[model samples]
Target: MIELRDVHKAFGPKEVLRGIDLSIGKGRSMVIIGGSGTGKSVCLKCVLGLIEPDRGIITVDGQDVTRLRQGSSERDAFLARFGMLFQGGALFDSLPVWQNVAFRLLRGSLKRPWTEAREIAIEKLRRVGLSPDVADLYPAELSGGMQKRVSLARAIAAEPEIIFFDEPTTGLDPIMSGVINDLIREIVVEMGATAMTITHDMTSVRAIADEVAMLHRGKIRWTGPVTEMDASGDPYLTQFITGSPNGPIETLR
Candidate 1:
C-alpha cells in the first residue's frame, strides 16, 4: 500500500502540487485523472522520488520513502520493488528488445545469469503478445504499438510488486489503444500488483481502475470507487469525466 500525506511541490514561482493526499490500497488499481498541468504526474514522481516534495510524507508499506536519497543503496533497493511504464516507450535504441527487457535482471540486486534472464525476457514478451523472434529486433524496427508492448514486457519482466503506468494508451490508434488497455487490465489483475496510473483517457480509466481519483489545482478534488464516479456530482469530477469546456476547470490559458 502507498500513502501521500499533505504532499506539496513547487517549481520556483509556479506551484505544481499544492497539497496532494491520496492512498492506493494493496493489490488495487487506482487511476488518476485530471486536465493537463494539474500535477498528476508530479504527484506520482514525488512518490517515486524522482521529484522530492517540498513538504509532507510519502510512505510505502508504512515506511517513509520521501526522505530516501536518490542513488543511495536504500533508495535503489526500495525502487527495485517498483516497475514503471513511461508515457513514451522510453526504450533503448541501441539494445535489442530482449536485452532492454532484461536490463534490470542483468545487473543490480536482482542480477541473474544471461541465459535465465533471456528466458524470462522471452516469457514476458509472450505475456505481452510479442513472439520470441521479436526479441532479437531493435526498437527501431517495431511499430508504435509494438514498441509499447515491448515497454510493457520490460515493466513486468521482473514481476515488480508495484507498477506505475504513465499514459499507457497515448500515441496509438483507437483499436490499438483498446488492445493496450485490455492488456494492462488483464496483466495487472493476473499479477495481483498494486497499480497507479495517470491518464486523461476516460475509457482507459474505466477499463483499468478499481478506484478513481481526480486531481485539480494540484490537489485531489475527488476520490471514489470507479462505479460511483459517474454519479459523484462533484463539479470538477463531472466536468472532467464528461469532457466539458465550461466548468470550474478552465480550458483556456
Candidate 2:
C-alpha cells in the first residue's frame, strides 16, 4: 500500500537516506530496525511528505505524495488517511485527556460535535485499556504507560487506514514495553491497518513485526519475514539483533 523508490535525503554534506527502496503491503506490519542516526526516521518522514526527498518517488495507494503541497486541502485529506504515534507520546500538556485523544476530531475536516467527539474519545481510551475516568485528567496525571496508551488511543481514534509508530516502546520498562507492543500488534490487526514502525528495540520488533527490514548506513541492509530474521545470516542484521560489539557493524567505544 506504500512504496518508496530510490529515495534520497541529505543535510548539507551528510546524506541520511541514500536511494532507499521499500514497500509495505496492505494490512501488513513492517518494522525497520537499525542503530541511531541511520535514517530510519528520515525515510519515514519522506514517505509522510514531512521531508522532501532530494531524489526519487513515494506513493501511497498509488498516489504520488511528493507532489502534494503542504497546508493544501489535498495534503490534509491525504494525511487524514494516516495516523501517527510519536516517540514521546507528544500529548498536549494543558489539554484534558479526552481533548488530546479527540484532537483531530475537534479540528479541520474531521470535526464533530464536542459531546460526540468526547464519547468517541472515551470509547477509544477504553479500547486501549484506559478507563473512562482517566479521560478527564491532564497528561501530567498519567504514568508513562498510561501516556503511551493515550497516544495509542489518539492514533486510532479516527480509524485511519495506515498507522506509523515511531519507537513505540521507548522510555518504558520491560513489562510496560511488552504491554505497549502487544497493544500495537492487537490494534493493528483488529483495524487491518497498514503499519510501519521504526525502532531499535528488538523486543518491540519481535512482538510487532510480520516482516522486518534492517536499515544500516542509510540503506536497507536486509529485509525478510520475522520468522526468517534470526537465520537470515546477514552480518549487519546478525550484529544488530545479537547486540554484539564484534561483527561487520562498527561500534564506537
Candidate 3:
C-alpha cells in the first residue's frame, strides 16, 4: 500500500537516507530495525510529508506523495487517511485527556459536537484498556504506560486505513510493553490496517510484524519474514537482533 523508491535525504554535507526502496503491502505490518543515527525515522517523516526529500518518489496506493500540494485540500485529505503515533507520545500537554484522544474527530473531517466526540474518544480509550474515567485527566496525571495507551487510543480513534508507529514499545516496563504489543496486534488484525513500525524491540517485532527490514548506512541492508530474521546470515542483521556489540555494527563517536 505504501512504496518508497530511491528516496534520498540530506542536510547540507551529511546525507541521511541515501536511497531507500521498500514497500509495505496492504493489510500487512512491516517493521524496520536499525541502529541509532540510521534514517529509520527520516524515512517515515518523508512519507508523511513532514520532511521533504531532496530526491526520489513516495507513493501511496500509486499516488505520488512527494509531489503533493502542501496546505491544500488534497494534502489535508491525504493526511486524514492515515494515523501516526510518534516516538514520544506527542500529546498536547494543555488539552484534557478526552480532547487529546478526540483531536482529529473534533477538528478534522470527523468533526463532531463535543458530546459526540467525547463518546467516541471514550470508546477508543476503552479499546486500549484505559478506563472511561481517565478521559477527564491531563497527560501529566498519567504514567508513561498510560500515556502510551492514550497515544495508541488516539492513533486508532479515526480507524485509519494506515498507521505508523514509531518506537511503540519504548520507555515501558516489560509487562506494559507486552500489553502494548498485544494491543497493536489486535488492532492491526481487527482493523485490517496497513502498519509500518520502527522499533529496536525484538518482542515487538515478533508480535507486530509480518515482514522485517533492516536499515543500515542509509539503505536497506536486509528485508525478510520475521521467522527468518534470526537466521538471515547477514552479519549486520544478526548483530542488531541479538543486541550484540560484537559484529558488523560499530559504535559511532
lDDT: worst 10-residue window of model 1: 244-253
The global C-alpha lDDT for each of the candidates, from Candidate 1 onward, is: 0.93, 0.95, 0.94
TM-score of model 2 vs. true structure: 0.98
What TM-score, over all chains together, does every model reach?
Answer: 0.98, 0.98, 0.98
RMSD, every candidate, angstroms: 1.0, 0.8, 1.0
What candidate 3 gets wrong by more than 4 Å, as runs, is none
Q: In terms of TM-score, how similar is model 3 to the real structure?
A: 0.98
> Candidate 1: misplaced stretches above 4 Å?
none
Instruction: Put down candidate 2 lDDT per residue, 1-253, tens digits, no spaces.
Output: 9999999999999999988989999999999999999999899999889889999999999999999999999899999999999888999999999999999999999999999999999999999999999999999999988999999999999999999999999899999999999999999999999999999999999999999999888889998999999999898999899999999888899
Sort by lDDT, best first: what order?
2, 3, 1
Residue 10, model 3, lDDT: 94
True-structure Cα RMSD, model 2: 0.8
> Residues 142-250, candidate 1, lDDT per residue (tens digit)?
9999999999989898899999999999889889999999999999999999999999999999999999999989889999999999999899999998898889887
lDDT of 2 at 170: 89
Residue pairs whose backbone atoms clash in candidate 3: none
